[model samples]
Target chain A: MTANWAAVLGSCAIAYAIKLSGHLVPHRVLQRPLVRASAALFPVALLSALMAMQTLTTKGAIEVDARIPAMAAAALALRARWPFIAVVAVAAVVAAGVRALGWMS
Target chain B: MTTKPRSVIIRDAISIGIAVGAYAISFGALGTTSGLTVLQTQLLSLLLFSGASQFAVVSIVGAGGNPASAWASSALLGMRNGLYGLRLAPLLGASGWRKPFAAHLTIDESTAMALANDDPADSSHRGARTGFWATGLSVFVFWNTATLLGAVAGSHISDPRVFGLDAAIPAGFAALVAPRLTTSLTRGLALVCAVVAVAVTPSVRPGVPVLIAALIALTTAMKFGEPIPPTTEDVSS
Candidate 1:
């Protein structure tokens, strides 16, 4: 438990460092095109990677299942411009229902 | 600087609260499912509201990784928030005291809400302030509350996998990523990074694959020299 707390604090500290680094440096220095460009792409890069991991992996293996149904529901939600909550709820319900009904066990 | 209406701030806060609170239910359920004690689950939600990071930590802990490794993986996944703080500084950089709070609120959802406003030129500051406070407080309250609820009642809610709670992460990511698909370069970069990450996930730690994908996307963006599109909406009143 002590180790876990230490790990959590350490992680928070590291996150704080990264955040402070940008502010500590002169604004002019960071305004360079290269720097701005790099910063702009960071979220896209990070999110893409995250999405891949979440969508493609299943218990340490690469396999597809009920995710296909969820993705279809997500597509509909996106097209309809539904709120985030609505989209998530719809996907969960659909996926769950499919699994519960033994359609995709 | 003209002060924004209190009503607007309140509305933003409420909306954020609802959205964040709903998501926290899943977080809490996941925490319990992963075998975390109630206190630990609540603490994770309270301290680390970043969904991806929390998920990584819980997965590692569940898989029997040491605390240090879990923390490292979670921290690596959360590095994107640092980038968000940098982008948000100009808009929300108030005095010294508020800086930390503002930074805390600059997560993915708040940033998107602020950037999605209709009047970016005149209302950017107000939007930023609204987004920051709304998201920060909402996340803080909703996450802790949902975690507590889940911890207490998690057992009754059997078969979280059956409910497809796991899909929340992907759906959330899609919402974030779909908006960025304005340009071919960005779309291409996103595609390549996702494909690469998925392909390599079997071999490496889960977080490491994403980190490598980030690197690949960044390098690709650098080489191609693409411009970021302007804000999708302007919330200037």
Candidate 2:
């Protein structure tokens, strides 16, 4: 219980540090091409890492499950430019549907 | 008299705010189902005020990752907000208390709204300023309200698995990241990261693989030499 609180507060602090520290950065420093470019791509990297981690883990191994189809459905929704809420709802349905079909445990 | 363009900005901000806020329900439900208490989920949204990082942390802890790893990975996800703030600071011109308040609200939607409304013709940056504050404050209020509503709803469920929400949470996460995979390079890197993480997960602890997968982003960005403009938030653009 205590660990949960600690992690929550610590993560919030780090997030604020990133925000406030960015404010402290001189404008000229941010204008640098490398800094600007890396900042733009960091989300792609971090989010992609998240995507893989979420998709690949099941039962403590790299296994395909209902999540695969569900995510595929979501990727398609994103491509079609569906809004965020719709994408999530569609993914949930697809995953739940796949499970209902007994496609995977 | 609101000009056409000004009304458009307001309209867009409110629509986007509702869109972003509605998604908080998913986060609340999933965070609760993933082992976080309702208050923990609510606190994550209120304090962190970042959808992706909050969801990621809850997901990480729910998956049994240690607190340190969860916080580290969540930090990496939140780092973009710093860059976002750097881009926004001058436009906001916030100092003292307003500075921290502005910093807290400098999220993807706020940044995107401000950038979208950049008016080269307007010397005062009125459009951008309005966009930032409007979108930021609206999203914040709606998101927090929606989070509480969702958490209350989530708390009523006797067993989260009965609705298959446990799987839905990760699937929802995948959906969130899907739009970012615009290029073949990104898709390939994601695949590689997935493979590596899976290979490592069996032998290591739960949270370690996502941290390891984070390396794939760095290497790919280094090799590619340009980071794509963020597409996750601004779907219309």
Task: Please name the candidate that would achieve the greatest DockQ relative to the true structure.
Answer: 2
lDDT of 1 by residue, B4-24 (tens): 565776577666667667766
Model 2 reaches an interface RMSD of: 2.3
Among these predictions, the greatest TM-score belongs to: 2
Tell me the spans in candidate 1 whose CA falls farther than 4 Å from its real position.
A1-10, A22-24, B1-4, B35-37, B51-93, B108-135, B150-158, B229-237
Write candidate 2's Cα lDDT for B1-237 as tens digits: 222276787888888778788989888887777777889888888889987788888877777777898788888788778778887877777788888888888788888888777776666778888888888898998898888888888878877654666656766666666666777877777677666776777898877777776666666666666656544355325
Give candidate 2 regions above 4 Å deviation: A28-37, A101-103, B1-7, B229-236
C-alpha TM-scores of all predictions: 0.75, 0.90
Interface Cα root-mean-square deviation for all models? 3.6, 2.3
Cα lDDT of candidate 1 equals 0.64
Q: List the residue pairs that clash in candidate 1.
A: B117-B233, B117-B234, B117-B235, B118-B234, B118-B235, B119-B234, B119-B235, B119-B236
Q: Tens digits of per-residue lDDT for model 1 on A16-45?
A: 565555444466665666555655565566
lDDT against the true structure, per candidate, is 0.64, 0.74
Model 2 chain B lDDT-worst window of ten: B227-236
What TM-score quantifies how close candidate 1 is to the native fold?
0.75
